[model samples]
Target: MKFYISTLGEFDIKVDGQSILRDSNRMYRIYKLFEYFLTFRNKKLLPETIIDNLLSDSESEDPKNMLRTQIFRLRKIINALIPKGELPEKYMNLNFTNGYYCLEIGENTIVDIDVFENLIQKGDKEREYDIESAIESYQNAISLYKGLYLSDNAYEVWLVPTRNYYQRLFLKTLNKYIDLLKRNEENEKIVNLCEKSLLIEPFEESIHIELIEALLKIGQNKSAMQHYEYALNMLEKELDAKPSAKFINYINIIQNYTSRNNDLDIEAINKSLEEELPEGAMYCSLEYFKFLFNLQKRKSKRNNEYDYLLSIMINSNNNKSINDVFSVLKKSLRKGDVFTSWNDNQILVMLHNVKENGTETIKERLTDNLINYTRINRNEIRLIFQPVSMENTIL
Candidate 1:
């Protein structure tokens, strides 16, 4: 497939048209710098701005030499793609005006994003014109998306706009795809698509609200209400904002029918969880635990868990600083294990799995681990351990 990097205006490098070894880190950086340039194609992105965009907070001294090396490598890659004899003249024809390399491929270029956007827009019209054509466009749009538009780096100014633009385009295409599916009476397919969209873009309040709407359209009011509440709560907690007026209106409509929005099927899970709570497992106050666990279960990457767990831990410990407890837990986990100091003075150790008698060994290992960790800080952080098993051991 041809590799087209849209810098100034979106340059095309047809690989099938030419070949080059394009795996240098510098080449990738230039690709990114060009990407940023493409997003703000009309504006002249400066070299210093590109350097600042590329550097991390930890990066020292603006590496001009490094950047120069990358630009050279990018030029070499472009040159290597040209035929040996006709290269110099054809390349000289390209522009590098005012420190910004440009790509003036008019409309014939097969850019994945451009193709996706065009097909998505045409898909919408095709829905009106012809069902077969619309389906074809949606398929084409989905195919061209590749992955998230420049999902490599978010902090890079170049990557961010390109990422956001492509992301918005991807979602637009996805919504159009869902709309087409809905028109075809493929409600089941739409439900799955809505679910996947919500997963990919949980921050998208509209999509969640749409999910609820779609669920309700299929008479799945029970599940619909659950999603509506989840979506609203997510917006409130993460964004510190209320649900949109449209969503509130949706909720009001749902409530008017039969208080269906308030009805929840949490009793079953609660009952199971309660049964697991031993005779005196100290399940005193658990709202925060439930919230943290739910958030982690849904999306493990949410950093709010750390603050939430710390808050609960500090609050429960008679306002005493539970910093040692937090430190011990944080240091104990290898990489992907979840351990939370949710209860003040109460530290819960979460391990993936241990051998049959490994729980006992793990308990001792944990105690030793905490002692070693706690002593270094010289803080009084005596913690209790509660191992809550999800699907295996009962109370």
Candidate 2:
């Protein structure tokens, strides 16, 4: 019987087109054993190594005995996959010889990870001679990576290195494939490929850069700008760091793209620039807020105006969502004020031209509005204010 094993994104064993091993709480331990064995099939593994990797956290007094019991259970499960009359030993073997245990499977079994590596090798070999053939091989290999390796076992410490290795290999192969496509002037294909790769590696700055470059190549300037904003926000929010210089350079490219469009009249340009029925306070991206804050600082110094930066820190245990607080801020503040989420539990607001005493009054007003709108206790919200100047760093 043919055994098809999948272990890249998930764990599964299909015998002759029938799924036998499934994800279930009752069979988790046994399934993990089977998966580990299958991953290192035909290799002699010592009992100590297996126990340390699999049962290191267990409270059992005798893990060796526990391992034996689990192995026996796994053998039963494997035997059930064989035909009614065939001997299970002919198809699979879990044997302990000397001081090591080994799992041997018949040649009929096919594993996805093996196939994925083979395809990558094939692509590399063909890359020097046949670009088209190499691209096809790389595409097939990339398609096999549905997600991170063993994504279901994300929290397993032993799987971390293996997972990172596969992910790096995937990103490397994908970048090579994208380079081949770029050489062929296949911008559309590069766009599609990078977009899909982003789903698998969303935080990968290189993939985002590739996608934005491809979009720019196809003259999709607007789409490129939109993706730039998304990438910027994602990096800031998820990683708590600014993007690299290579990524920040895209903003200049986008600006150049906009400046090249000379077909519009002054009236149309003004119409496009105007906001539709301006609301209470303007909400901007953190990056844009930084620029505004800096500009306001310079203006405040020159005009001798009193501008304040107010920070609202929300308690983590509050029942109200951060969005609820943001909504209230958008309506409660004046039209000249601006705000952005400083972090997961905090927001920073720029209050323009407020008198020394106005800080207290505005703080009270916002506190009251938040309490009334969110019905949250006053103690759960903390607001701090400082004059907007060169000394203050909002970013």
Candidate 3:
């Protein structure tokens, strides 16, 4: 007789071809005992340990007796579920000796977690030598990780560590598999793998970055930008934090490459800037902001003009879009200054020939303008003036 126990997404058992559902009190407790015993099947557990792991919350005063009764119930259920003479005598019995209980297993019994671990080991061993076989093994293992382990028992403290351990293993195996795909220059496969991984770990920044990079490699800049925006919004909303500098630089690269039309001569490039005024902040893309910032640094070194970068994030009592805040900023800031949206909620501004005190005055004027022009409350607008030198980068 073949018995299968699956604990990856949910705790389920199949005896032969029929599944055991939790439809009866006897069946439910039997399932719990079977699951607990299979989880540590190789070891003989004391009644206290088994009770603690399986029935720690039970209201029964004498858990040792309860555990003995559960073992008996488990044996009866196994006997009735499996046909007569189908399972070996050893497999049919719940062995209790010297105050220890164990679920004796037969050769035909299978557990999904054990199979998953074995496949991972095989994949790791074969990846360098045989790519196709390794990928097959990895795919098999990845499919086994349907979702969080013992998801029905997610809040159980005892399950947390085991769940996290399996999760880490799954991710490690997946990342290695992805690296192998990358070695084969399988960009589409890389994107697919990243998307699959993200389904399980949606907030994983590394996976998101990898997906974006893969899409960019295939000239899918628009798709990559959409993912970037999604990731940016998700991270900010969930973690109250920004993405890493590496991620922002990747965005800058994508935008810079996508925005290029053709090579322009020095005179044409110079003429493009002729209409811009010298004082109010100029709005630009992240790529353009980076270029102008570098240009300003070079010019500052030669001309001895002190240039600084300031970051502004509106603290609005009501949520407002970046365009609304930018409208107020355009009317308030100096004409020669430049600015760009670091994200939807923040802006990076370049101020030329400004000292510490000048920034304070600029902050006050911007605050007043935001409240007066946009009707945002004065207390709801916050101006953060972080002075960045020519040698530094700001996001």
TM-score of 3: 0.62
Q: Candidate 1 deviates by what RMSD?
A: 12.4
- Quote model 1's TM-score: 0.53
Runs off by more than 4 Å, candidate 1: 4-28, 37-67, 80-100, 104-109, 142-148, 158-162, 255-395
Instruction: For residues 1-395, write the lDDT of model 2, one tens digit per residue.
Output: 67788777777778766788666798989988887787678899999999999999999999999999999999888777777887655677788899899988766667888889999999999999999999999999999998777777767777788788888899999999999999999999998888677656677899888888888778776566656765675476456788898887777776555545524566644542343223677677786577557656755654577889999999857556688898898799986788888888889998877976998899899999998988567888899998887574655
User: Between 2 and 3, whose TM-score is larger?
Assistant: 2
Q: Relative to the true structure, how large is the alpha-carbon lDDT of every model?
A: 0.53, 0.80, 0.71
Number of the candidate with higher lDDT, 1 or 3: 3
Candidate 1 pairs with clashing backbones: 6-10, 36-158, 313-344
Instruction: State the lDDT of candidate 1 residue by residue for 271-293, as single tens digits.
Output: 43333212311221244234324
The most accurate candidate by TM-score is 2
User: Poorest 10 consecutive residues of model 3 by lDDT?
Assistant: 271-280
TM-score each candidate: 0.53, 0.67, 0.62
Model 3 lDDT at residue 145: 90
**Model 3: lDDT of residue 118:** 100
